[model samples]
Target: MNQPETNPDAPLPRPSTFPDGLRVQVQGFDDQQAADGLGEQLTALFVQMGRYFDIQRLDGVTIAIDYEEALRSLDRGCATRELAPSRGRTVGVAMTPSVLRDGVLKSHVFVDAAVFFGMLKEDRYERAMQLLAHECAHVEVNAHYDRCFPDTLLRTKYMNAQQGARSEVILASWDEYAACALSAKRGENPEADYRETFLNDLADARERGNECIKAYRLHSQVGQIVREIREIYGGLMKHAAYYLGNAAGFGKSWRDDPAVAEALTEHWFLPFFERLETALAALYAELGVWPNHDGFEVIGDIGEDLMCEGGMYFYDSPDHPGEVGVQLPLTPDTVPY
Candidate 1:
């Protein structure tokens, strides 16, 4: 493996290898038998997901086992450094007691190693799969965004404007949700069963006015705020269902009623996408950049446009009231050289 060229006078360049073409390298293991076993398992899982990334399992991709090296490599090269570095460095999975107890899945993307050895040691195959899927989804999403979004907007607008939030996280969550949902629908293993059970319980809890269950599961929040939001949304949804069912004579099963479904589908999903668009637009505005329709055609683009328009143009005005946009502070401080 080639080591990153370090220059104290300049920022480091991002790693250029594509995830699909990269190979996995393992280190710190005592024997070949153990490494091979883990490699085969990972290959099988990757194949199952229909991801055709080249995964060469070798020993000694890097001298250090930690992820910081890869992160440093990314920070030097990429303008938007967060998701790409972490997603790009994952190579192999290892078992570590600390990770297991903390429920953290660490990736060394530059070296192409991801550690799931901890989960496997605990016999948590299903959870392991979920984590793998999540990380892989990050790579996929980042690739898609790179291909779809313009390079100019990505660097000047998207990278500079959006902070703390990651497209990888959004994509990963959606992937996990879909995978878990499919597994549950198919009556799969323990992990799938748990996900399905959780969704069902959330549904039940929402019906019974159980605030905790409704909020945490639906909006991905913990504690009172989640509960409050869930309660409000659930109540609104329920009331909407009641009104539609009564008007349509669809009986008490409005949860599955077509009318209610139509309303939520038309109202909720579209608005959600619109809000995302507004947020992205606002971010662009902060960077003094504007996105053309070509780059903003898809969901990611929509998000960018929304942020720009809402944050930069419509914020604090009743004429464009309720327009969602990015909330970046004006005149951001210069990043240290």
Candidate 2:
């Protein structure tokens, strides 16, 4: 949908200066050597991101692989504490095989351990770096959002499973989009990076030898889905709005009826979806890109029907099939990198 172009020349907003104690821990692996190696690598990565995002004052971030402890921390309501106002911090990293195969769903980050091991096995350090960078970007985005609009975006919980799913899809799109943009500039291979990280490792060698074959295939399939969603649908901002809006409308309808308050509370995406569009626009502008019709178009193809389908549709559709509407203005008058 079309929105007024965000001024490309606008000054970028800086990340938070608050001292949120960010930490990362690894779990499910028994090999001390592997755990230590992963921990060191993750620590360096966080340090780099902290400096880049200007969160130095934030308590040092941690990376651990203690699946049991991580689960315990999460089960005993660790997220409640982690998300507490006074102790606003995030914990996550490249997940181990066991965690991915059989861990309770948490809001925590999950990196495919097999994929990670595959990258390491293949000696694709550059690809591994890209994966690490992508996960780290999520942390940066989450922290930035928390600091900038804690009440509006961070506090509202998704009202239903549908809304939650929609929010997640959009969030994942943006995460990958940002990661792709950053990785491209840094000379990283997105496909190889994802493939090696998600598909190449075995989660259960004894139960299912060569099991990763199917998992690897599935990874490739999902990777393609994400790419198609970005290329065909449009940018993350537009797609996210489409799903989030529907979810929000659904939640509001239920909330208006007191009988469904419990159900609504359990299933809304409002918490994360609320203000997501604005936040994305701000981020796009900060990155020096215009948040105009053309920018959204390049992110994906939003036709008249899909545009109208969402309440926020703003861009004009093409006159005919297989055509672009208009090119949005970008900063520096140069092509998008």
Candidate 3:
């Protein structure tokens, strides 16, 4: 018997449960008496978003809190950075998993309830809820992809091909585009001005990275690594700001832009690296270490298939394997410190 090859980007075999509405659950927050109230609000907000996007649904989300022992005490399944309590603006982490809980396969989410409430009290109410909505969008996308292509093997972005990504990458970018644009449709703030916050984060990361690059100017390896990180992430940040700022029409706001619409629908990565690579090569040719190699190939040793934190997603780069932290995954699985 011959089964047809499955298209990696093919739609899910089954329909989404959104028509029935999604569900949410909270765990591990009893210690912080205030956590329950926040959890309840977050859950309600997520449910409302489900009604809005209505494309895919999560089985259920398991949001947990751990604020007493460590100010930041949560980590998602495959975190690229170690989380510490000292990191200010602390909010608990979240993740989506398809694993057995008590010997039965359960897929859900976990979050830090206390940290979330703290942010809420600080009047960051809009941003806090938006983050939750973004994470849910991620789970919804991943959940559907997992079921349809349960055995699909994806490569880490470490090689050179350009412009193609895994279903996972598409999932990440789509949700990011949607999450940012969703503001016009479902948020308390009509335009959801918080989208600019990501640009601020990007500027901070790049500025800090530039400082490190200058400090290690003589260190060839260090310089090259820093350069790569900036170029790859810079493109995503640029696109995120574009998608978020463009103010797409309500209901799948990402669709408002023809480019974003087609890129996501066709399952391709925008921000072609060639231009960025060319600029980088010219900028660093004086270093005399980059030209010796064809293109970056360190992903095998360092890249992880998935890295999640609320707004940022570091995963396989579609065009080239061995690259992590390039595409945007909206569903950020957090780690408890």
lDDT of all predictions = 0.33, 0.37, 0.40
Off by over 4 Å in 3: 1-25, 28-49, 54-59, 67-108, 119-129, 143-173, 182-184, 190-195, 198-210, 215-232, 235-246, 249-337
* Candidate 2 C-alpha error for residue 99, in Å: 18
lDDT of 1 by residue, 1-337 (tens): 1112437796423432233533344444677687666555554444444332211211112322454544344322234434323222122332111011122122233333444555556666555555544344334333333334434223433332122122322332232332222222111133323323323432333233333333334554333432243333333322232232222221223246353344446442335333433443343232213244332333333333322322221133345554333332232221111
lDDT of model 1 at residue 324? 30
Please give the ranking of all candidate structures by lDDT, highest first, separated by commas.
Answer: 3, 2, 1
Candidate 2, residue 166: CA error in Å? 6.2
Compare the candidates by TM-score and give the number of the best one: 3
C-alpha positional error of residue 199 in candidate 1 after TM-score superposition, expressed in Å: 9.9
C-alpha lDDT (0 to 100) for residue 232 of candidate 2: 28
Which of candidates 2 and 3 is the stronger one according to TM-score? Answer: 3
Which tens-of-lDDT digit does each residue in 224-322 have in candidate 3? 443444333443443453345335423334446465455445321223322322322332232223333222222111112211211222455577666
Q: Indicate the TM-score of model 1.
A: 0.35
Candidate that beats the other on TM-score, 1 or 2, i.e. the better one: 2
